[model samples]
Target: MKQLIVIGAGQGGLSAAIYAKLKGWDVLVLEGREQSGGKAGGIVQGDYLLDPGPSIIILPRLYEAVFAAAGRKMSDYLVFDKLPTISRIYFEGSPPLDLPGTREECLRTLKEIAPQDYRGIQDLLRKLGSVAPLVDKTVFSRPYLTSKDMLDPGLLQFGLRFNPLRNYRQMVDRWVTSPLLRAFFYGFPSYGGQTWNSKAPGAFLIPYYMIEDGVYFPRGGVRAIPAAFEKLAKELGVEFRYNSKVNEVLGNESKATGVRLTTGEVISAHAVVSNADKLSLLTPRDGDPGWEPSFSYFTCHWGISKTIQGLDHHVLVIPKNFETGFEELYDKRTFPTNPIVYLNAVGALDPLAQPPGKTLLFSVVTAPAEVKGIHWEESKWNYVKSVKSELRSAGIEWCEDDEEFQRIQTPSTFAQRDGNYRGSLYGPDEPHRLMGLFPLGNRDAKWDNLTFCGGSVQPGAGLPMVTLSGKFAVDLLSTR
Candidate 1:
């Protein structure tokens, strides 16, 4: 049987393993960590089951597609519950906006909060719905290998869906005048580590999926999603080796042979699929100075003794002056002293998340990837202060003394644990130019047997994209 070796057991790697197995190849997945899920992994502290990363789960249909492609039903392996209240946005000095999952409910809320913009909101939703399919079919489903790919006649169907001239912020500006709503809308680009000024088309559809398609949470915990994938892969006869880190990709001048583990064991395979940070593979020794690192996460996990009231399962605390905050973060390349905070209280949705009467807060602040001047250890306290102040202002409270348990994860911690270049959660920053919007290809141009799948590669980040990325890689390999 043809053998395939995948380095890393992230969503993309596991998905690739499953696809390869389905194609009648013997597959082996090597994961450095004791478990799977990559950044989406969970942490169990005392009575609290904490999801340290990727608290929001959008586009669950994409996940279901992966299982369906394997001739199985996702519900058989995992249970997903749709959230009625998707997200509650808290803006400084303004009334809060509790966004519901349905368009009718969202319009009702908009009419209540910003009555003047109700019709405008309706128009924007229509625009989002019109463009969503184009975005998915034109960019999300296919690979962009060359400039010619952009000229594909089918792209004409995308129409004004993208309207290449307007930035994401500008697109949102066309619909609403309220800063509170604008901030909420503009924040979607940050999901892929891009700014409001990103010219990448298809970003507008983010709200369409969140509001119309619906947001969901796994029944047991966020970790349950990956656990389900891993289980299915195992049942398919794919082998997994935990705590096995690959030190190098063994290759000839023309193609890859396999991977060499840190433990000095050499595993041979017909092809190699890497789910690690692409830069780690590109550099091998000292990284390229020219490559700008992607945004990393500054996460604070707290297990509070009491439940926090007036918070949805997912809550976003928008900075009062969002423009200045973005400037400080993207332009000045510094830690966000007054950053927006995303607080996920999954315990509100999943009873298994924490003990009764207690809350589990997983707070996230997007930060620049690790670089020379910034010191995470010294700056962590300020991040904590910013988070606490934002949470308090938004009417949620957590005290170090009152906490049953607390832990902090900085970029350095992520680097030490996952070997991500400079703790970048995604591979690289989303390119601002239209041409650069397409990520690096799934298959290597020079090495015939080498391919990549993960946040760093084409189709980009997020659970859905990464899972599809694996399929893209496998399809490419199978064609070769």
Candidate 2:
């Protein structure tokens, strides 16, 4: 048996491990964290359950592929319910937009938002219908090793349905007339820690999944999906070692040979795959500084005493002064002290997410990676106070909003726990010019017997992209 040692236990890592085991490799998963699932992990605060990461499970078929590859069907392994309405958005008095999970319902709801914009939305939806196949044929089928994979003339037909050349921001600006509606539609790109303007045109598929494709919640929580995978992988002979952190990637003759753990065990394997933050892993070996941090977040995981009136499963409250609010966040990177809020009340939608009479909200807005070190130290607490005031000022929060159980996640917590590159999420904004070549395959990447996967790599970010990245890695190894 060829021993395989996977260096991380994130969604991509776990998926790779399970698939590798099925392919008949001797698999040993070494996770640095106390548990698996990486950013998709959940937190249990008293009786309230919160997943600060992964708002809703999109691309059900991709997740299904993960389960099936692990030798277990989703139904047999766990119960996941389809959310009737994928998510509901609050545009304030403009009327709430419920992103229903069916095609007809979505079209209907979108028409309600804007009758004139209906034509554009329908055209965009038709464009999205072609995205999955385009991805499979162009980027997903092969690793992004050469410039040709992304820019090949042959692949241009795949992008013809939608103009990948035009900036997405331009598209949104042209397609939607209402500022509130435009912001709501563009929120999809930013969902995965990316900006609509910076992300390629292909990301329009995000909303396609949200409304037409559907969203889901695991019967237990997001953790249930991985826990089931862990069980099934063990059933098929994959060993797991929690708290076994890899200090370095051992190499011989310029090729990876094994890994060195913090406990001093050098576990050699025929193949090595990393699902950890690729950017972080790159820093250890190269002795270089990353470009700059991506956007950081200040999230409040509040367990409200009772559900507030007029709120839905998902909410995006546009501030009375939207431009000023965004300028503070986009230009200053401060806590959007009074910025528009993106909120999700999971318990309101899924009872499994929280105890009775409680609501779990994942509220976050843009902030700089580091808080200027000193200035924010003085203003940190005050900034949070201001943020709270802003939320209530927007009329989304009421008198009892803060009285319930509450917890907050800051940059410091994520920095130490997740070892993310630069404490930012989603990664270094896809590097304007590096979009073509930079952040290429990790120097440690091996093709003969080893492979790579994850958001930082090609085919890009998001659960589906990363899942597809892992699947691509498995295909490479199996072919060899």
Candidate 3:
């Protein structure tokens, strides 16, 4: 049997291991941390479980495909409940908008919120639906390893549809006129660390997917998705090693033979798959231009003593002065004075995940990636205070008095924990993004036997994309 080694036990790594094992490879996964799931991992405070990263679940079929590949039912390992109201959008001084799962409900809600933009929203969805299949075929199915791959006629035509000349904000303005709708659409680019001025019209597909396919919450917590993958991978005969940090990828410039652990243990394999941050593992060639740091997140997980009423499973609070916040974050490269807040109250949906009469709230704000000027150690707590103030202003009366326990994660945390370049969750910044849609390729450019799979690779960030990235890496290896 062919010997395969996978570094990191993230969603991508676990998926890669499972696929490789089914292909009859003797697979071993080496994780730097003591457990699996990477950023999708959970934090436990007393009896409450808090998810520090990736709360929203979309495109669950990507996960289901993994189980189907193994001839096992996904439901047997993981249970997912589709959220009826995907998120409640709370705009300052305006009535809160409930974004429902199905198209009819969404349309109805839009009609109530912005009567004039209802038609615009419908047209936008139609346009997105038309291009959805092409996006899947061109972007998701493969990796762009060279200039030729990007210059394909089909891909070029796809790019032209979005009019790369205009930025995301311009594209959104053409689709809707209401501030509420604009607020809802404007932030999708930030999901991949792109800004409004970024030439990333492809970001519009995020809301398109949410409205079309529906958003889901896995039973137990967001961590349950990776837990499911880890369980299935183990059952399929893949092996795992925790706290096994890789020091180097050993081989020549053209190929990777295996990895050397930090303890100086040399483990040789026929092929090596890296699910760690590719930037951390690969050395940049001479004259290779450095990538700009992309946007990252500041997260606060709180286990509160009591639940806040009128809170949904997912809630988005858009400040009235959000444009200034965007300018501050993207152009000025500072923490926004009026940041948009995303609050995920898992207990609102899953009662079992929380202790009795307690709430599990995870709040996130988009922030600049770790840059030289801004020191998180000095400013993180101050930022947290501001975020709590914003939460209270939005009617969530969470205070230090009500807090049972709190856990905070900043870009610095991701930098240390995941070794992400400049602590960017979505790899390189927007201006330097690959074809304006992807991260790096799944196959390493210099090493034939080495591959990459994770947030920093093709198909891009978010749990669904990383899950697909694993399959893309395996497919590249199989083809070689």
Candidate 4:
């Protein structure tokens, strides 16, 4: 078997290792962390186990496909409980709206909430349906290698189905009339750390997936995702070196040889697949285009003695001034003073997540990588104060006396703990133009045996997309 080395054992790295082993390659996964899953791992505080990283599991099929491709059953390795109510959104001075798993149920909820705008909601769903096929068929399935890939027939089909001229926000405004509903729709861009006005095409499908296919929770926790993949990789004879960080990619002028670990140990391989952030490994060239970093999170995981009523598993608290909140995050590059909060509780799906009669509240507020003129060291407490205030306003009133455990993780923490450049959740936001939708490819054209995966590279961010990125890297390497 030809030797292959993979740096970082996150979702993408684990997936790549599994695939590479199946292809008859000797694979080794080098991880800087104590365990796998990168940002998608879980933490335990006393009796409560909290998944502070990725709280939502939108697509289970992607994981199943990977397991199936490896000649295994995903259900045997992992258990997923599909959510009926995807998210319950709360807006200031308005009644809370629960977004159901099925489109029909969601439409009924919309009709009940806003009788006059029911027809417009129907139009919106129809438009989303037309746009969704293109997404499932073309965008998500493959990587864009060159400028020529943009001209692929599937991309042309996508353009013809959806309006090529109108941006995502403009398209949303065409059908959604209610102010609260519009605010709810705009937040979809945040999934990729993009603004509502971004011209990114695939963002329109986020709400569609949540409503149509439904959100889910792994039986154990989010950590179970990587745990299953790691288990598969180990069974396939792929070796993992936990806490062994790769110091550098050893390569000649045209091809990568292997890697040198921080412990002064060097391992050689035929190809190197880096699942770390691209910026952490590669420096951009002069003529190459530059992009701003994606928004990172300031998360608070609270273990409370009691659960709050009228709150679903997932809830979004939209700000009274939602636009300004986003502007502060992406445009101003500062903490959102009036931030939208994504608060989740997983106790319903997994009782082990919290103690009996106790609940875990995992809250995330979007923050910039580097706040202008302000250091997170001095300002993170203030941000936590703001999020707590927002939680109170949204009706999750808990006492300090009842709190069993509390820990705050900011973007700075990500940089220090996970080696993420500026703690960016995703690499960069998708460019709004048709050409911009094409992210950086998996393989480096200049370096033959060097490839990249995870959120920073092509087929961009989120759990499912990064999982696909790993497979795409192997596919590209295998063909070469």
Candidate 5:
């Protein structure tokens, strides 16, 4: 049996270990934090159960299939309740639109609120629904080997359906003239931390992932998924060590061998799959190094005293100024002037998140990649004030001026805790096999006797896809 070592026990890492164990490999997972799930983590504060990130997971169907592949069932280890409403969209001053789960319901809501924009919303959905299956087959399923591999007759036909060259922003401009509907569609680009203007219309699949897939909440929290993974891994003989932080990727002349931990332990292994941020692994040292890591993120997790009734289990609130909003996040080297707020109130379903008469709200906004520790004190206070002001400015109220159940985290803090490349909470970017983003047979890794999995590797970030990345890694390992 090939001994496999996985670094970083985040959801992706834990999932990879589970998949590898199912394949009968001797698997060991090394994690920096005491728990698994990395950025997709959970914390318990009094009656409040705070999901540090990944507030609620959308698409319930994917879970069962993945769990079964690892010799378990979703019902056996976890439980979740379906949500009645998905999100509430409020842009500018139009009447707030509450989006239901079904396609008919969403169309009806669009028609009821923005009658003029309804036809466009319908057309966009029609176009997307028409081509989404093709995208899953032609782009998402097939691993990319080269740009030359991108020449697909099906892709051309699908591209023509969605007006491919226009970009998602341009596509929205032509379809929904209302600021509310525009914000409704464009707000999804946040999933990949992409700017709406430059975001590829190819991402329209996100709506499908939302409306078609159906969002859900674990009985515990988002962290429950990874915890389930950890349990499954242990049952299959995978070893886990928490608080074991690794600082360097160890190798000789040609390729990576294992890792060097912060405690001065050089653990050797036949293969090393990193579940940590990809860019973090590339941190350059004073003496020398290889490739570097990429990007940064600032995430704030807070617990609230009251239930946020207006929002569904998963709500994405767009700022009044959508375009100007992204410009500040990407170019200004600061937090969004008017941040796009995303609220996930899973407490609606899993009432265990907070005390009675209290709610758990995960409200987050994008901050610039330029995070320095120097001015963070002022930045944190400013972020709190700005988020509160934006909500009140839009007539949404949940907290008093003096409510103090909040905590702010900057990218610099992420770097200090665990070496994240540019403080990227995820990795440099997600790997799409169909896009040829990750091409090594069996997930098909390119490096021999060595493969990369987790968020930064092929099949990319998110819970399900990362497991697929691990499955692919094991397939490659078998051939050797």
Candidate 6:
């Protein structure tokens, strides 16, 4: 049996291991951390379970497909429930807009709130829905190995329907006229580490997926998704070694043989798959210019004493000066004074998320990736105060007294913990993006038997995409 070694037990790494094992490769997964799940992992504070990463679940079919490929049922390992209220959009000085799961309910909400932009939003969804199949076939199903791959006829056809050259703001502006709708649309780009000016019309698919397919939540938590994959992988005879960090990829310029651990132990394999950030492994080649680090997140996890009314499972708070916030976030490379805040109150859906009578709130604000002169160690507490003030203004009030425990994660935390490049949630910045909309390829140009599967690699970030990336990595090995 051919042996394969996978570095990182993240979603992509675990996916790659399972897929490779199914294809008759003996698989071993090495994780730097003590467990699997990578960023999707949660923290336990006494009786409280706080899932700090990836609150919303969309396109659950991607996860289901993984189990299907292994001739197993997904429900047997993980159970997912579709959320009725996807998110409640809060704007300063205005009635909050509640977006229900179904398209009809969403349209109804739109009609009630912004009647003038109703038809425009309807039309936008219609157009995106029409071309969604084409996108899945051309963009999602394959990796862009070369410049010619980008100009593939199928990709060009999809591009015709949705112009990838146009910026995200331009695409949304073409449809909705209301500032509320625009503010909602503007945030999707940041989901993929792009800005409003990023040529990523693909970001529009986010809202389409949410309103059409319905957002889902796993029974346990976001960590349950990765736990499911880890369980399935173990059943399939894939081995996992925790706290075994890889220091380097071992091979020559033409082929990758294995990986060298930080402890100086070298393990050989027929092929190596890396789930680490691609930037950490491969250097920029000709036509593949180096990337500019993208935006990251500033997250605060609070275990409050009481539940806040009107707070849904997912809530997006758009500040009054959101335009200025965007400008400050993207162009100025500074944290927005009035940042758009995302709150995930797991207790809203799952009763067991916290101790009795308490609520676990995970709040996120988009901040620029770690750069010089931005001293998070010194300034993080002040920023936390600002974020709390913003949250108070939006009606979810909490004081230092109300807090059972408070924990925060900055770019520094992500960098040290997950080994993320500059602590970016998504891989690369927009201007120097390796591939305009698509992520870097799964197959390495320098090493023949090395492939990558993660947020930084092909198919882009998010739970579903990273899960799909594992399949892409295995596919490259099978093809070769």
**Model 2 over residues 149-213: C-alpha lDDT tens digits?**
45764366665655655666777777777676676665554544555555356557677777776
TM-score of 4: 0.94
**Candidate 5 segments exceeding 4 Å error:** 142-145, 148-164, 284-297, 306-311, 330-334, 371-377, 398-404, 429-447, 476-480
Model 1 alpha-carbon miss at residue 264, Å? 1.2
TM-score versus the correct structure, for each prediction: 0.95, 0.88, 0.96, 0.94, 0.86, 0.96
Alpha-carbon shift of residue 166 in model 5 (angstroms): 1.7
lDDT of 3 by residue, 145-174 (tens): 777788876577677676767888988888
How many residue-pair clashes does candidate 5 contain? 10
Over 4 Å off, model 3: 283-290, 435-437
Per-residue lDDT of 1-480 in model 1, one digit per residue for the tens? 999998899888988999889998899999998999887777778987777777778888888888998899999998888888878889888777788877678778878887877777888788777767676776667666677877865566664456678887777787787877777777667667677777744666677788787888888788888889999999999999999999888888888888889899999999988888666775653356355666788899888888678777888899788777777776777877778888887776778888998888888888887866789999888789888998898888855788877789998887788777677766666562236566667777667887889887777778888998888888888887
Over 4 Å off, model 4:
283-291, 429-434
Worst 10 residues of 3 by lDDT: 281-290
Task: Indicate the residue-level lDDT of 452 in model 2.
Answer: 61
Query: What's the count of clashing pairs in each model shown?
Result: 0, 0, 0, 0, 10, 0
CA lDDT, candidate 5, residue 328: 65
Give candidate 2's TM-score: 0.88
